[model samples]
Target: MRLSAKRHFGIALVVAGALMCLAGAALYVMPGPGFPVLALGLAAVVIGLLLLAALRRE
Candidate 1:
């Protein structure tokens, strides 16, 4: 199963991505479930959304 969400290039998403990345990485150091990798992946997706939204801006 997959979930789809509308892309929105807002600052909030960017912040969330950064937070996720940092936290995930930290967790990874403490013997976690690929949290850093997951964070990076999520950040990448958020970045994509940011780009899409930015382009939409007139």
Candidate 2:
């Protein structure tokens, strides 16, 4: 099946967000702006998922 560019972008965002969240989780134990990273990751994930949802509706 062919995927639309919008869908591809949404998937990329989801993947990047997931990776960021993973990195943040790792940083949490290392001590160094952990909270900020975690927050940013969470925000990215939320935005990405929202984008995905929007794209799916289209």
Candidate No. with top TM-score: 2
- lDDT on C-alpha atoms for all candidate structures: 0.63, 0.78
Please provide, for model 1 over 1-58, each residue's C-alpha lDDT reduced to its tens digit, 9 standing for 90 to 100.
Answer: 1122333434456666766777777778788776656667586757867665655673
- Model 2 alpha-carbon drift over 4 Å, by segment: 1-3
Per-residue lDDT tens digits of candidate 2, residues 4-52? 8777777787788788888888888887767777788788778878988
Clashes of each: 0, 0
Q: What is the lDDT of residue 42 in candidate 1?
A: 85
What TM-score should be assigned to candidate 2? 0.79
Model 1 TM: 0.51
- List TM-score per model, in order: 0.51, 0.79
**Which pairs of residues have clashing backbones in candidate 1?**
none
